[model samples]
Target: MDLNSVYQRLNTGSKKWSQYPEDVLPMWVADMDFPVAPPIMQALKNRLEHPLLGYSVAQDTLRQTLVEHLARRYGWHVQPQDLVFLPGVEPGVNMALNTLAPPGSGVVVQTPNYSPLLSAPANWKLPRVDLPLQADANGEYPTDIAALQHALLSARTFLLSNPHNPMGKVFDREELQAIGDACVRHDVLIVSDEIHADILFDGRRHTPVASLSAEIADRSVTLMSASKAWNIAGMKTAFAIIQNADLRERFNAGRLGLVDSVNALGLEATHAAYSQGEAWLQQVNAYLQDNRDYLAHAIKNRFPGVRMHLPQSTYLAWLDCSALDIQHPQAFFLREAKVALSDGLEFGEDCGQFVRLNFGCPRPMLEEALARMERSLQPPA
Candidate 1:
């Protein structure tokens, strides 16, 4: 629960740490810098008591735990059998696209989305219809319903990222309801990614898109995981809730060889995360919110050229560096500041003036990154 404590992840085979040089600070990836919750570690340790590390299936208890969790946390009731386990959310996405959406059909995705979600449509040879999120006067990003409807007209599927990445905009219930109604009207399948559902700021609650109504649930494929919230991405486990029996069967069937079964330890860790990690989650959410506030303050006070709105859900910040007069913000920071961040171009072609910074690390680390970035902006002597 010590949010300020820093751990050495440089040589720990961490994807986030290993991606950048030893001297560079990595604030790019979505993974957190904190260690796993004690309960999660204990669950893994308990599972290791058994010597077999072979492939495994999700136990009935695990499924029931998830079922209870969905209902309790989001007020979304789902049957135990409605859940389909997968190695990760991306595969589930590809599975839904490959099986449900027809080839050459249009897939509607919001702009400035996660790189993988933005590119998944192309992997299936489907045309991607871009719908950009516009910010209001209050610096809040709201979905344009008319634009969404227009995009959905030709699109067969809508890939939704609730508690959206990069922007960290959590769609309100009204917005979600409107979107679901629109999709239902257009006969568009909904692939809702709620991976960041459990990570929210300002006491905001997460609402599952399918949970809006039973009719919406029928047409929706909700992909969720404990990875983002519980800091367990390396476990490689996630689940999809397909309420429609036919769709669920089709989605499970499409996992052709490329998508495999979940590992034993991941299943245990997931159950522990839901069953026992609530206290840990509460602590971490508070810490992340504070970190977000500090980062926003730093951007406003220290960096004149950088602009960022407070994120409502996730720890990632979409910083607009257009005022800084930098051609490529990501590359500039990486080379000049020795700070590696996710390039805005990866999110969308029009996002070249932006860079996504992950602030889920310890406070000192976040402060250090900001200091390095601030120093990089200084004029040469």
Candidate 2:
């Protein structure tokens, strides 16, 4: 329960930090600067203390931990038999693309999504069906069911990023129901990448499309992990919940063993994080909320031209840098500003004038980052 010691003991082997050793700051990658939960660390260490690390078989304890966590956190009851293990959510995306769609078909996804979903279709020879997120009165990104319905006939699957990656829009239950109805109507499988389901803000909540209705759940393959929340992504383990027995059988038939065997240590860490991480998670969520507020206010007051939304869920802040009249504002931020952010253009042309900022860091680190950004916007001397 003491997080201060864990913070001090935060490892230096993190790719997001160590990759740029001498740099003042590194916020390009999605990994958090904070330490993993003490319980998770202790669990991983205990597993390491066991000399022989062999292939892991899912135990009752691990399965029950996930089931109980889901029931308590989001009210979704996922049976242990309905699970399929994967290395990461990205692998699940790839597997979904490979399994659900016919060879060389289209897959529908909203723009400004995680960059990998855009390529999952292309890499698997599935044509990219772009359903750009329509901006609402609040300027928040939302699922466009109308565009999706129009495109569904030609597409085989609808890849959803619930608690969407960059924008962090936790689609409300109604919005999800509408999207789910559209997918079911089109006979399309809804493969939801719900990696951030546990990261929603105070007012917002993550409603897994599968949990909306039996019809939707039957057609959905919900992907999730403890990596984002617990900061153990290097462990490379994730879970897939597929409800429909027939669909599950078909969907997993194409497994090339890309991620069947997860690290034993990763499993232990996951079990601990899910089973005993409530208090730690509560603190981290509050910290993230503060970070979200700081970034939004700082950007608005310091750089008036920039448009940034405080994510209702994830730690990422999607910025609309369109007011900056540069060729590629994201590239300018990286090269001139020395703040490497994710290029929105990479996610989709629809978000061409945008950038994704990782604000999951110490407050001081984020302050320094925002200051550099403010200086970057200054005119020539």
Candidate 3:
């Protein structure tokens, strides 16, 4: 895995590259710039040799692999029958909302969440209740348990992003326990997105909220995938773990002919990822941590106008450009610096001054982006 080598994705129809002009550096999307793990690539190649591309289902081996993975990595034991395959986590979320939530009921979601999670409730005409997570002096975002309980009063389902996106906040055991207890108290179903579970930094362990107790497990739909960690988002495969058979059946029914079966290659790659991609993932995490530190240092020393907290997980960094006095930081960088970043407004209404940067690239590319951004902020001669 030569992560330092920059691959050319310019003419490859890549979403990250194609979204911006030729001159602009795109550090916006959640996907990484590195190549897929060797094992995943080999699995896909082997699967292609079969010469049949029809509708597919997950094999028993794949389920067992995932079951072993969860138990070994997170110490979260789940039966093989608990998994429900899906095309993506977003659809799983919408499915949970459509089937589990009463029509026109409120859905509780933390503010500044991934755009899809933030907007999924509206797709089913469910009201969205926002519970904001604020950063403390140490730059850690802690859940407001009291506020969460209050919000759950008006909501029937809770949309959670564990190892959260945009802000890159990872919830600890205590926080997750509080959240699960509150949901259990209020009878609110938990729809958690744990897609980035395997990408933690600094030896942090991931805890599935449902794994805390049987009571929580009965009422939770936890969605996960290897896409984010393995750089295989293009495969478009994810799964949900529903311990309650009744809830699993209802969630599968909510597909409504819109969400189809998982991709054939995705399933093969997923099995390979869980079984043999750990070494590759470990290296990627270390590289990302270094990139994160470099970016944080650059922001502090070069771009004084920009403020950012060190992300606990994932390769995305939430940058606060409030001090720069820029009305729209995303647009400003795109126009003046030729650097494309995810606009904060998409995550939350009050995040207009913020922009999310993806640090999952070669070190040279990260340095180049920082250089361009620093030059863009310089005072006129």
Weakest 10 consecutive residues, lDDT, candidate 3?
135-144
In angstroms, give how far residue 367 of model 1 lies from its true place.
Answer: 0.9
Residue range 96-146, candidate 3, lDDT tens digits = 999999899999999999999999999999999999999878778899999
Off-target runs (Cα >4 Å) in candidate 3 are: none
Task: Put down candidate 2 lDDT per residue, 1-381, tens digits, no spaces.
Answer: 333232422255766755543543576778877777888888878887879987886688888888887778779888988887777889888887787777878888887678888788888878888888867898877777777789898887999998888888888998899999998898898989999888868767778889888999989999999988877788888988998988788778867766476778788888988988878888888888988988888887888778898788888988888887777888787777777777888778767789888887778778878888888888889
How does residue 114 of candidate 3 score in lDDT?
98
TM per candidate:
0.99, 0.94, 0.99
Name the candidate that leads on lDDT.
3
lDDT of each: 0.94, 0.82, 0.94
Estimate the overall C-alpha local distance difference test score of candidate 2: 0.82
- lDDT by residue for model 1 over 121-174, one digit each (tens)? 999999999999988898888899999999999999999999899899999999
For candidate 1, list the clashing residue pairs, or say none: none
lDDT leaderboard ranking: 3, 1, 2
